[model samples]
Target: MYGGADGAVAVLSVAEEQKHLLAYAPLVKRIVRQLNSQVAGAIDRDDMEQIGLMGLLEALRRYGEPDAAFGSFASLRVRGAILDELRRQDWRPRAVRQESHRLRDSVRALTRKLGREPAEKEIIAALGITAEAYQEYQLAENAEQIGSFDELLQEGMGQADSAPSPEEQLMVRRSLEQALRGLDEREQRVVQMYYEFELSYKEIAAVLDLTDARVCQLNKGALGKMKATLQSA
Candidate 1:
């Protein structure tokens, strides 16, 4: 679909950039593939790849010295670009969000009516929705919860424009530390594996012998606790 002269220039630019990047196109592809799977069939893999390549170019420009850390630095920027695009896509349409709200409202009403939490059967009967549909609703909410938490984590990991003063930096790290302590042992491990080690949820699930869904749930719970702590701070 690329036209004549502009297309040639783009191709040449990418070729030149890749040379300076030390041929890190594989890293971009890996990140895009991993993220595409989690997007639930929303974004086209090719489009994400293009965004990732642009990110790598930006990384190389910003990173004047291609030292030992260039690979790590470029990887973060590439992944960040793809993640930002995913958020912008907001694959969950307005209809899906409205439906999620309705589902939560129904569950709340059922719990209040029962004087306690309602069982799955009770919920299905009251809402007249299939179990699979209910699961879809839960999945939507869980995805959003973890996505927000990732945005917070990404910013904390040096994505800011202006560097904070020493005191401010210490305070921010302390806030994160306090927020992390609110998690359980396993949840702490999950956070470390994610933010420290930069492992995917699927990878974490394999290491912990838990399903991806279980890992997401743990992160979602941690997000709730951390957000409350941050708000109160």
Candidate 2:
């Protein structure tokens, strides 16, 4: 249990707390940097560092034992804290969020039709918009949203500095595959097409002959199971 600030803490206890903070400070800094990059300048390093410090305090409060792998717990806490901050910012307009499904569908269709990476011009044409209007829409609607193809894939299939390492990437892929393997074949294909191929949920629903809500449920359920399995592993 954490003592109150006014309590007279022992010197050795204070020293141990200082040591723990010293050891984790670098990790917290790294977390802040990683989250800052992921946010694409929406929030700066210092802001994220402040949020990460709060996460560290929460982690320390809940950490059960010295040998209980604080780093992993702290990692999740920091990420959660950063995401909470982003949510509090309300970065996306509600209209944009509502239209994102349609925009994503358009993007997927345009990409599939082109059989290669579609240029912004191609995307605009497919969406039937003037270049100026498309640019405005992109700026207004898609600026800080996560989980899009352009953001997730990075430039030309290369990972960014913020992306996971090769080993972690492989582990994630294997974990996903294993989780999918346990699902019904149809559900597996639905998830693969939607996520791996960058097809939108609408496209997946159309191809799978299911309602959009059903598709969403299946995808969410599968992903939740996959997350649980990976975390356990």
Candidate 3:
């Protein structure tokens, strides 16, 4: 237990730091496990664990008494830290990222012109690509944009030095929900199943009676639309 005066900013004793580290080691492990399953082959689990531990230490160092539980706040910080590292070490090819951006722009343009979420066929036609080429593009874009939930969660959190207030968090959640509402029914289901339920693409495909490639395409398209909506909101 820390023996310092309440709410005072002071250098923690080595023992105090170690105590907090030991106490939160399990939390770090749990976060690493959850993120590991989402990020296969992109980054090693041990590396993520190390990054999570650093985040835990950072949380302990900067944390203040707030209405929210320390664990909740720490979890956000830990996950944010891990995500920061992932972004820093992003290995997606430049061409893939460019193509993904182009696809997103095309979707946004078509949605504006159609005054609704564009269908998959409409998107393909807007991009002036064959169905087979569109599938390849979707697969490539999906591969590059996979595991984007981190960014989604961190959207309104602001900087680490100024963690989001409870009200801010609530507003962010509401914004996310509203953005999701912009998606079509099928796109909404795909997002819920894949992210909320943590289902694999193959599993979601089976449940939705769509091909695996189609699921990936829908997932990427839905995410792109949500992102645009959130940004506009």
Candidate 1 lowest-lDDT run of ten: 1-10
Name the top TM-score candidate: 1
Decreasing TM-score order of the candidates: 1, 3, 2
Runs in model 3 deviating more than 4 A are 1-40, 64-76, 93-140, 146-149, 197-203, 206-212
Return whichever of 2 and 3 wins on lDDT.
3
TM-score of each: 0.65, 0.46, 0.59
TM-score quality measure for candidate 3? 0.59
- Model 1 clashing residue pairs (backbone): none
Q: Write the per-residue lDDT of candidate 3 for residues 1-233, one digit (tens) a residue.
A: 21243535456676887887888888788777655644555678888899999988887777633334457667777877887787788755678678778877887888999999877788877888888777666666676565465566666565445445556678877988998899999999999887656567767889999866698878887888988988887
* TM-score (C-alpha, index-matched) for candidate 2: 0.46
lDDT of 2 by residue, 138-158 (tens): 543423433332222232223
Q: Compared with the true structure, what per-residue lDDT tens digits does model 1 show for residues 1-233?
A: 11243322123355566687557888887777666656676778898899988888877665543555556557667877877787787887899889989888888998999999776678878999887776666667675664465456445545432223344456667988999998899999987786556677779889999767566667777777887887787
- Quote the positional error of residue 81 for candidate 2 in Å: 1.2
Candidate ordering by lDDT (highest first):
3, 1, 2
lDDT of each: 0.70, 0.58, 0.73
